[model samples]
Target: MTLDLPLIWAGLIAFAVLAYVVLDGFDLGVGILFPLVQGEANKDEMMNSVAPVWDGNETWLVLGGGGLFAVFPLAYSIIMPALYAPIIIMLLALVFRGVAFEFRWKTRRGQFLWDWAFAFGSTVAAFAQGVALGALVQGIKVEGRAYAGGWWDWLTTFSLFTGAALVVGYALLGATWLILKTEDHVQRRAYTIAFWAAPLTLAMIGVVSLWTPFLHPLYVARWFGWPNILLAIPVPLLVLAAAYILLKGLTERRETSPFLAALSLFVLSFIGIGISFYPNIVPHSVTIWDAAAPDNSLSFLLVGAVVLVPLILGYTGYSYWVFRGKVKAVGGYH
Candidate 1:
């Protein structure tokens, strides 16, 4: 039987995106929590907790984007133009956030500026990412293989709500991460933050779940229609289960479980999205087959991806393993 290159590539890209979200998300969440956390030492501990692995966590993002460009050029072409504004903002924010990571250590007098930059960059990056996701889910207007929507088409109430929702979601991730990686006051504050953020994140997830189906008829059919609904039912059930674990972990004062549960919620939500967008790389506008590059190109790229992806995974796992355990309050990996 012939290989289904497009489908394989789609799965690979999806996995990469999920890896990036789960791995890098907590660090970004930490940055978002920077404002709420006081004391230079507390912030230092927060930064130190993620410092060793934060940059490496972004490798999946590069892989996902590059895989899309090489394996699904049509989708990239359409999506880039459609999301140029938000994508650009996300990139800039990431640059600033990255700079803050290093420079914040170098300067004593200007350290506050870097702190603000880190927080601002992380928040904006997270928000832009969510906005881009919302705009895509809401549907990009594609005509004749090109984006036909106006420049401002992405700016909508739904998109704004999703952006805000992501901020809270990231904050939850950050708080849970802090609970896992810090001690004393930082851990206590994280517990307090998680208590509030967990409920808000769940409510936002519920709202977004309800609001998404109305954006397009295809989504309604995929989510609410017959056999598809059977598949769809488990997503929310799993989300509810995850939410319970998250709350229980927080209340019971378990450090690791809350973080794992928060990650599970994101995973469930992602799977729900995948269920909605199966077959269509650009939602209603483009199918995986229609948007894919030539088969020969895919086959060639697959060989490289097969080798590189595993190596990436191996090193990523090793880095985390090496850095595992609570971040000490004093000298650290940063």
Candidate 2:
């Protein structure tokens, strides 16, 4: 079968972003849950739970960005300039969090300081990405392939809502991860957080669903349209079912059910977004075909990705296999 370069690139972009969400999602969730952890021993256990896999998780972000730059240059050109401030803030937050993750355990005097920095950085990075996502969904002020909006244009009530929603969502992901990786006190605390966080996340999704249609008439029309509406309905229903199952599993203290349910929720939520924003990379601004790279470039990258992506998958699998068990409080960074 012949390949459609645009579809291939789109799939690659989607895979990269989803990988980032699931992989980095756990570490960020750990960060969001940082402040709630009590005692040095607990903190050490939390850190160990993620330390083996956290750095590797960021590979997806790099691939996602690279795919955007190589395959959808137009989207990158428009979005990078429009979100310059938030992008910078997000990068800085990642850097600080990475440093704190390592340095906090190497020293004795300023551990609290690093702990706060790690948590703050994680929250900042997660929220900023949400804001950027909201602004993209809302449509940037584009003029002749460049953004014409002011610095404050990105900061709106909608964006702020998106920011908070992402925090809750990531926290939920973190809680599920804890359920899988920790034991006793930490796992119990995670269950409690998941119980509350899931409902709040659902509320945020409802608000966003209602608000999007009003903010952009096309989205409203898309949902109201016959066949599309039928397809869309199942996504949300699946998510709700997954959320319910997650709560039930947490309540029953089922070992693996909570994480499976949470993972299903993430997958369903991603499908909902993908359905809403199909064909459009920058929402109302540009369609995927309009922003696609030259066919030759896409073909070359496809060749490279076939090799690189599998390697990433293999290494990620190996790391998880190597570290598969409840984390212990070893009291120091390796």
Candidate 3:
């Protein structure tokens, strides 16, 4: 049997990225919801709900970045330069969010400022990630294995729209998580957000669906042309089904179902993205094959990856398992 290095690395990195989005996404959602939460008690409950696991959730992002650099150095070289600013902004925002989470408890005098920092940081980070996604989807400029676009080219109209939509999406995810982890007023608020956020999320997805094909002829030709159109039916159907279930779960106040249903939407959305941009790791400009590292390096990396990836997964799973249940306001940040 032949070893397909590019395909293997793509799958590995894609898994890491998806894991980060789904796990860290909900916690970021919690942070984004901070401004809307009125009571300090409720806010502490929200923070407690995710405090144990948010740090672990971010580990996948680091793994994804490292995997990309090791397995596809050229893609990393081109993409890092093209998206230098937003990437830095996203990282700094995450740092600020983390710091706020830590220091908000220690300093009572400046607690209000820290709370705002956490909420603002979360919103900015999520928006920056959405901008990154939109920029890639809109396509990057690559010339002779180098970045061809200007520094500000990443901020197009579509990218901005995508950023706003991600805020909604992350908000929905956060709401569902609160439903599972909180009770009383906080949980009710979460239920309400989940109910209203459903439509806005779907609408954003709808607009992106309409706008994405026009970005490149390949997307139009691949997804809507000939028999490929027929094959793409399940994606939308699954998304609609998940959304319906999410709405139903929220309405009924089911604890676990809402979170599971929301996760389904994210997973399916990623699957849709994979279908749209398969083989192309960097959208139109660079492909998995075009930017893939040498076979020997991939082989060496695989040895560490095969062992390291599973350990990370196991640790992450164990952490969640350890912290599973409702979050009560324990008076202070324990």
Candidate 4:
């Protein structure tokens, strides 16, 4: 089966973005979960669990952003202006989180300050990312490759709602990750958090799913029409099943199942959105075909991409493999 260049590029960038979200999400979740942890020792262990690979996990975000810019310049042009505010905030927050991760263990007297910085920065960064997602799904203002809206146009109620949902979702990922990466009191605490967080995540999913159809006729029709309904049923069904497994794993103290289940839930959410927004690279605006660069440009880019992307993936997998183990709470690697 042959494929259109634009379709191939769109799918590639979409997969890259999904990889970034799932990969970076749990570490950020761990950061956000820090304050909720009762003791300094537990928090240190939680931080240590992510310390080895946090920077590597973030590489996918850069790849995703660069791929979008190269493959779909038109969509990139429109999205940046619409989301510049939140994007800037998100970047700044990430910087804070990254810096805090390094500095928190470096200082003898300033650990308190750095710890707060890490937690706050992670929370804010995650929230801003959700805001950006919300703005995308809630519809951005675009006209002829430009954002045709004011600076505050992205600050819609629906966007805020999405942002809140993402916080809970990331917390769920973080807790599940802890279940896989720690033991004893820390593990139990993470398990308890996962159990509660999953239900909250589900409630948000339910609300977002029900509310989203009303936002656009394309999705409304696609989701409710007969064949689409039958075909689309699997996405939600899988999501629910994953949610059940996640909670059950936490309850039963199954170490890896919670993390794996959370990953499945995230994948299903992305799939649902992908299906609902088919043909649209940016919903209600640019399409894959319309936003794609010239065929020759894409072909040339694909040659380099074919080589570079796999190397990045191999390193990512290897880093995870090398770091695979329960974290020790020796006050983190300073």
Candidate 5:
């Protein structure tokens, strides 16, 4: 079978985004959950749970951005300008997080300051991305190739809802990750959190699913229409089932099952969104084909992916393998 290079690139970009969501999602969830940690010891255990794999989890984000720049320059140009403020804030938050991660360990004094910074940064970054997702879904105010909306235009009720939903979603991911990576008290707390967070996330998904159609009539038609409806419904139903299993696993003291089930729900929900917005990179503003780069640029990127993607996969696998097992309260960073 011959390849459709544009679709192939689109798939690669989508895969990169999904990988980031799963990998970085847990760590960001950890960050969001930081403030709720009861004591220094618990916080240390929480941080350690993600320390080994957190850095590598960001690799998929780089791939997502780079892939877009290489294969969909038009979308990049449009999105970046429209999201300039949020993007700037996100970058700054990430920088703050990186610094806090290193410095939080180095100093005995000002430890609380660093902890707050880390948590704040994580919340900011997560919310900013959520707002961007909401704006994209709600459709950006575009005229020709430029963004014509006010700065506050991005901060709508829908965006705020998305922001809160993402925080809940990330918290759920973090809870399940902790369930998998920690033991004893930490694990118990995580399981409790998961039991609560999972249902909240499910409720958020339901709200977003219902709201999206009313927010965008086109999306409403797309979802309610004949053939597409058949494909779209199953993904959400599967996600709901996964969430149910996650809750059941937590209650049964099946530690590993919650993480797997949580991951499955995330993947299914992501796939549902992808299906809902097939061929549209920036919702109504830009179709994938219109936003995609020339075939020559795609071919060049494809050649690089041939080497880079496999190397990334190998490294990610190796890191996880090396760090596999429950987190222990080692005295210091190793």
Candidate 6:
């Protein structure tokens, strides 16, 4: 049997992107919630909670993007011109956020500036990502083999809404994370913020879910049409289940459950997206096979990915394990 190298590469890229979102998401959330959190000490705890593994979490982003460029060059070429603005903004925000993460510890007076920088950077990055996602989902304008859209084509009401939704979602993740990894007033505050954030996040998810299907006939058909409806129905049901767990965990004051539940929501949403975009790497325009590089290139890269992905998983898991438990009130990872 001929191995489906393109399909395999697509799955690998999808996993890498999901890993990046699941892992780096909370850390960005921590930054998003930075301003809402009062007191230098509380903020310290927030930063410290994610500091150990935050940078490491971005590895999957590198893997996902690099894999896309290498294994799906055609898709990359089309996507880059289409999303150049948001993608650049996201990268710059991440760079700024990283600089602030380190510099905040070194200076006493300038720390306030760094705090704002971190918050702004995280928010912008998350928003840009959501915008890019919305643009992609709305369908890129492709002419022949190239992106046909002009500059500012990516900016739309739907994309803006998705951007806001991602911000709220990330904030929810941050709040839930704090609930798990802090104590005293910080935890209490997290609970309060989460109480509000949870509902808003779910509402945003619902809006996006409803709004997405209308953007394209394919989406509408894939979601609500005929036999596809049978398969598609479970995503929202599972989202409800996850929401129940998240709310129950929050109400019950369970530390870890809420965080896990939040992650479940993201996972379910991602799966829903995959269901919509199956076979099409660039959506509407390009199939996985259509955009994929030659078989020889994919096979060569798969060998490296096989070795690399596991090492990333191992180290990432190890780091999280090592850093497990609450961050203390005094001092932090700098």
Top lDDT prediction, candidate number? 1
Task: Return the clash pairs for model 4, or none.
Answer: none
The sequence of per-residue lDDT tens digits that candidate 6 reaches over residues 285-318 is 8999999999999999999988999999999999
lDDT of 5: 0.84
TM-score of each: 0.99, 0.96, 0.97, 0.96, 0.95, 0.98
Best of the candidates, TM-score: 1
lDDT of each: 0.94, 0.85, 0.90, 0.88, 0.84, 0.92
Candidate 4 residue runs with Cα over 4 Å from true position: 331-334
- Residue 180, model 2: Cα distance from true site in angstroms: 1.3
**Candidate 5 segments exceeding 4 Å error:** 331-334
Q: Poorest 10 consecutive residues of model 5 by lDDT? A: 325-334
Look at candidate 1 and give me any clashing residue pairs.
Answer: none
Between candidates 5 and 6, name the one with more favorable lDDT: 6
- What digit string (tens of lDDT, one per residue) describes model 1 on residues 1-334? 9999999999999999999998899999999999999999999999999999999999999999999999999999999998999999999999999999999999999999999999999999999999999998999899999989889888999999999999899999999999998999999999999999999999999999999988989998898899998999988999999999999999999999999999999999899899889889997879999999999999999999989999999999999888888897588742
Query: Per-residue lDDT tens digits of candidate 3, residues 44-112?
Result: 899999999999999999999999998899999988997888889999999999999999989888989
- Give candidate 3 regions above 4 Å deviation: 331-334
Worst 10 residues of 3 by lDDT: 325-334
Better of 2 and 4 by TM-score: 4
What C-alpha lDDT, on a 0 to 100 scale, does residue 150 get in candidate 6? 91
TM-score computed on alpha carbons, candidate 3: 0.97
Which RMSD does model 3 reach against the true structure? 1.5
Give the Å shift of residue 323 in candidate 2. Answer: 1.0
Report how far off residue 42 is in candidate 6 (Å).
Answer: 0.9
Candidate 5: tens digits of C-alpha lDDT, residues 233-333: 78877877898788899889897888888889779878877876777887777788888888888888899998999999999999898888888767433
In model 6, the runs with Cα more than 4 Å from the true position are 331-334
| Per-residue accuracy of model 4 over 1-334 as CA lDDT, tens digit each | 5559999888888888899899899999998888888787887899899998999889889988998899899899889988999899999999999999889878869888888999998899899999999889978777767779888988999899988898899999999899888887888888888878999999999999998998989898778887889889889889888988887887788999889999898889998888888888788877889999999999999999899889999998998888787887884432
Cα deviation of 7, candidate 3, in Å: 0.4
Report the lDDT tens digits of candidate 2 across residue range 17-121: 988888898789899999998987888788888999999999999999989999999988988888888778988999989999999988889999989988998
Residue 207 miss distance in model 4 (angstroms): 0.5
